[model samples]
Target: MYDEILLPVAPVGEANDAITHAVGLAERYDATVHVVSAADTAVDTLAGPRTGAFSERLVDAAEERVEAVTDELEAAGVETVGSVARGDPLEVIENAIEDGADIVVMPSHTRRGIRRLLLGSVTEKVIRVASVPVVTVPMAESEAEGERSDAAVDDVGGASGSR
Candidate 1:
């Protein structure tokens, strides 16, 4: 029943689950998948002219992310379009929705309790505000474990348990 499927990804490379899910849904519905990545450029004025350079990097990373996902979708035989936008992620996603997305498919990170509270959640916010259906693919267990391990290492000043 979907004519256009929207997939919003971060610049990270951990969205395979969401991509797979979107591919299946798009194939089933014969819908075009529109992949979008948001470059979060919200910065304080104290950053000054450096903000332009930093924003460019973010936008470039976001463009790469969109291209990667679009390639994956097209390789899977799904028609796809992609773009990178600069702004708050939620706002970017909402604008995509308004642009003609029938539904949204995205990955939800595995963060809990204090971490979840502190880091906040774009997926949660999207679910709350989206006018169309939002399908969330839970992050793979291995990915979640990797994130936890990375966090632990960072917490200990990059010292690993093995060393």
Candidate 2:
């Protein structure tokens, strides 16, 4: 049902669950997956130049994040690639879709109230704008934390290999 899939990476701290979940979906669909960093879009651009150090730093960090994700996915034999850009989370994600994503697999932290109002809705925006489906894994910090055990994550017919 989907072709190219966009799996936006958050951080080792916040996104561990998202990555694991996205990987499962990618494997099931035999899709060419992209593990991109959402950091560039989360930065404070008004505080820095278009190509400023802050932006550079953000992209650099994102590069590292994507690299780690690529390592994980590639080891699993999932076809994976990555990229970065700056804008509203939804807009940047839409750009990824434009580049060739057919679906976006994301995890929601499920924050609500003033936080959602002030920061606006990213996944909501993606759903509204994307021509493709966006499958969101429920935010499960607890399960994610414990997923290192084999009982949790199913192998993507994956093998352990180096990045």
Candidate 3:
């Protein structure tokens, strides 16, 4: 019944499962996957010029994330459209849904306790507010750990491998 499947991805590598799940569902329904990445510019905007630079970087990263995800989906022979929107993550997603998404498929982090509180769960928020069906793909613990390790290596001047 799905015609457009919305898949929101963060700049993190934890979205592999969600991407794969979306591909499968999109293939089954012959739906076009609209991949979106949010460049969160809502925080620390009082720095003026520096804030503008930072927001630009965020948008660039979000664009790269969308491109990578769309490339993967297209490689799998699934129809895809992608965009990088600058806004709150939830707002970007909500706007995509309003643009005519039939369903949403997204990654759910396993953050708990204080961590979850400090970094609010967008997936949980989407589930609560989205009018369309929300499908959450949980990231495996090992996969999450691997992503963290890769980030650490990248921070130390190591190159990250492709997905």
**TM-scores for the candidates:** 0.85, 0.71, 0.84
Residues 24-85, model 2: lDDT tens digits = 77788888888765544333535656636655555566677678878888888888887655
How well does candidate 2 score on lDDT at residue 76? 80
Off by over 4 Å in 3: 146-163
Indicate the worst ten consecutive residues by lDDT in candidate 3.
153-162
Per-residue lDDT of 1-163 in model 1, one digit per residue for the tens? 9999999877545445888999999999999999988766665234687867766666776677788889888899999999877667787889999999999998776777877776567788889999999998887988656545543111101111210
Q: Which lDDT tens digits does candidate 3 get at residues 75-139?
A: 99999999877666777889999999999998776767865675456778888999999998877
**Residue runs of model 1 more than 4 Å from their true location after superposition:** 44-46, 145-163
TM match of model 2 to true structure: 0.71
Predicted structure with the largest TM-score when compared to the true one: 1
List residue ranges in candidate 2 displaced over 4 A: 11-14, 38-51, 142-163
- Backbone clash count, each prediction separately: 0, 0, 0
| Local error of candidate 1 at residue 55 (angstroms) | 1.3
lDDT of 2 at 94: 74
Cα lDDT of all candidates, in order?
0.74, 0.59, 0.74
Whole-model alpha-carbon lDDT for candidate 2: 0.59
